[model samples]
Target chain A: MEREIRIDPVTRVEGHGKITLHLDKKGDVRDARFHVTELRGFEEFCVGRTVWEMPALTARICGICPVSHILASARAGDAILAVRVPDAAHLLRRLMNLGQLVQSHALSFFYLSAPDLFLGWASDPAKRNVLGLAEARGDLTRKGIRLRAFGQETIERLGGKRIHPAWAVPGGVSRPLGRADRDWIASQVPEALDTIRTTLRLFKETFSTAEECTVLGDFPSLYVGLVTDDGAWEHYGGVLRVVDAKGKPLVDGLDPARYEDVIGEAAEPWSYLKFPFYRPLGYPKGMYRVGPLGRLNVCDRFGTPEADAELEEFRARGSGRSGRVFDYHYARLIEILASLEQMKTVLEDERLLTPRVRAEAGINAEVGVGVHEAPRGTLIHHYWVDPNGVVTAANLIVSTGHNNLAMNRSILEIARRTIKDGAFDEGILNRIEGGIRAFDPCLSCSVHALGRLPLEVEVVGPEGAVVQTLVRD
Target chain B: MDLVIGIGNLLRRDDGIGPRVAEALRVSPSVSACAVCELVPELVLRLRDARRVLFVDADARGTDVRLGRVRDEGSRWGHTLGPEGLLELAARAFGSAPDAWVLSVPGFDFGYGEGLSDRAEGFVPQAVERASRWLSEGQVSADGA
Candidate 1:
């Protein structure tokens, strides 16, 4: 009498994933598992390549967040070369990462998750997409489009193009920000600021109830991200920090280069993505969430005045617990506000126009690890090269992979909440998919591929015979 | 706005004909050129204000360049929102869409890496000439003249 339900090709968010829910004969939600069905052995293939090719080659890892890889890989190379990238290049790299933060987050909010927020969860599945959201609120959708474009524009101005710029090199960047470029980039910030403010107000206003957040991946787990030395918020460069569900710091100022000592990757038979856990606690038990929610929990305050204010209010929404995974969407908006304010501060500096951007060097170290925050979460790139600078080993712990344990738990939580007593419908299906989208996962960044999303739910009795089948075409 | 978009993968041999032709086109004050791997939603912004736009890509269907206007259609999408979906998105969001045409250049090779095949290269000048005309004149004819 007990059966299993398979939701294949989970929709929205990024990449390809599926969820299998197991039920007792009484139709009660008994257990669930989330799986990553795609895989690309990215680290394995780059082993013999010259270390110098890493920044450019690894930039191709994920088109959505290549800047993260470019910066991370270049930072790793900088370690191998052992030269301090000039201040101007360092600032420029931060600028590009900020640009990345804006664009990738915009894509997650407007294009991927907006439908679930705007359209009712049970809205006609066909109309629950950006186009549908556009039909209802075209002006807002246009603004969203422009906001995302502004993020890409910032990158285009700095890296020479939005995706995979050849600018960030090992020792430093290949070019400096021109005065004209700075002025142009600076001019665009005010409108972006206005759009985000308008969006924040709308998200808070339109979300009239807190009922949705309570059941939507609202569970206790550890949170991890980068934090400034004094515990201020950070994304580009900072020490690794981990805070428990109660926001108590368990690990502080850990040398990111020594991440292996604390963070361990565990494999699950059903998924290609590794489950990364805190070493001190052990596998699955060491499970923690990352990305916006993690960063928000780990940081004491965003450095900017406006964003700091927003951060305080955002945290207050929890009342007496850790952040709800649902708040990831809210956290992205605050981060955008922070990024815009930060962009203004960076552009105002005269050093942005410096001609001395890069430092020259040869391989000075054998093993190097680059650590920083991708828009999604903390991304680490480790590379080992020979004295001749050819890569001997490479490892990449993508941001989505870090949240593997959290994502599966989120799916399980949503599935248990929605699927009860063996009842199934589209509403239950969407809530589950929406849970994954809340993370704005880039399976391409994690699994390194994108596949089609088709919906077909198959129910099989414990004897492995089909009990009931559902299809969406 | 007059826009010429060379759309295809430069890494896939002859499929890269699109960008090569875009590179050859004299995009100036009257026309702007964009070379992309494929169309995505962001390109909708560029299309919203355009008075005329031409999408150029290599196609295996013909031995010669064939051009046609993209039909106004449904707005479903995938990893790369094709030209039709992007135009549809532009129309939906902005209340109007640029007059858009797709020019598919026939090619013999679409293997890995850059550069067009000799046969694919042979058609570039023609594709470039037609794309230039479309962006400037905003015309569509049965013959693609």
Candidate 2:
């Protein structure tokens, strides 16, 4: 009498995925699995390519977060060269990463997930989208669009193109900031700051009382992200930090090059994405969360004044324990504020206008590992190259991969609370999707094998027979 | 000024038509042309300053290459906004939306890889000719002829 429920092609997320819930004869949820169906084989194909081409080649992995890959790959190249990037180039890289954070987080909160937060979850599926949000709240929609544009414009100004710009090179960036570009970016900061502030106020007022905030992926889990030496929230360069669910620092200031010693990837048969876990604890038991929630939890404070104040208020929301996955939305908003503040500071720095942007060097090392915080979470790129600088082996631990284990657990937790006696209603189904969306997992970035699997849901009986099938094309 | 934007991934087989057409049309001095991999919301700001805008892309729904005016439509997701969505954003955010058109090239092969399919490549010249005609006609109309 046991039955299975599947939700295929989880909508409103970056890439394709599904959730399968196993039920007992009593119809209570027994287990849940989150499946990533497609694979790109980036790691395999990247081998034998010249290390110099990594920034540009890997940038093509995902159109959405190519900047993250470009920067991370370039950092790896810098490691291979064994040369420090100039100070101005470092600051410029930080600016570009902040722009990425702003655009990406805005896209997640406003475009992808806002409909469920603003419009009722059970509302018409047709009306539950960015267009619907625009129809109902035009002002908010406009602000979201403009905020995203501000981020994209910043990238375009610095990197030369909106999507894949090969500005970040091995030793440093390709060019320094021009006066016009710096002034234009400086001019846009005030409005960008205003938009984020307004968004934060509105989001807090609306969702603070919602029941979804408490039950949707609210369980405690370990948190991981990068932080500056003084423990400031950092996106570009920092030492890796891991904190337990209780806000205690389990490990801090670990060298990113030594990431293999601290973390390991575990593969599951049903999923192409690898489940990355803390090395000592082993497998599922070492499960930790990343992205906005992890970054905020792992960092001690935001260095800027306004962001630090916002961070204090954000922390007080959970009474100092802000591990709830639902809080990721708020964490994204706070990070946006911090990014804007950091951008303002960086743009005003005169050193960025210096002509010296890159450091020339030949490959000095055979192995290199680069780590940085992508919009999703901590991303590490490891490469082994020959003396000729051709890649021998490549491994990428994308942010979504690190959150794979936690994403599965979250889906199960939400399903247990929402589904009733094997009922697969639309509302319950959406709640399950909402849980996954809360993490904003990018399957395209995580899975690097080979498959073009369609999104499907199969209802299986206790005897392992397919009772029903649902396909989303 | 008038703008022509060709949008699609150059890495995807037939999807590179948009950029291909844009590249071919770059010789025309009457309008500005560029190729982008995707149509993002940030395009609205760039469109706001233009007198007219044309977006070119490969479409599986089309049987033949066609050109038509852009219309405002509801969007289901955030990232997949098309020409119409960008126009709508322009109108909503800037209070003025430019005249916009979408030049859709019918494409059969959209699989992973570079270069256009033979069928899609056959239509490239015609697509370029049609886009050029539109630009020339627009120039004549704008000149008060």
TM (chain A) per model: 0.94, 0.95
Residue-level lDDT of model 1, residues A1-473, one tens digit each, is 89888888888767788888899999988888888887776787788998789999988877788899999999999999999889999899999889899999999999988888888888988778888888888978998999899999999999898888978989989998888989998999999999999999998887646786655678888989999999998987789998999989999998889889889987755677778899999988999988988998999998999999888877677773355778889889889999999999999988888999999988899999999999899999999999989999888899999998888888888888888889989878888887888888888777632221233566879977879977643
Candidate 1 Cα outliers beyond 4 Å, as residue runs: A448-473, B136-138
Give the top-scoring candidate (DockQ). Answer: 1
Highest TM-score model number: 1
Docking quality level of the chain pair in candidate 2: acceptable
Model 1 pairs whose backbones collide: none
Error of 1 at A443 (Å): 1.2
Each candidate's B-chain TM-score, in sequence, is: 0.90, 0.87
- Model 1 over residues B77-145: C-alpha lDDT tens digits? 654578777877887898888887888899788779888888888888888787767765645584544
Off by over 4 Å in 2: A210-212, A449-473, B23-32, B46-52, B59-65, B70-79, B84-99, B106-125, B138-145
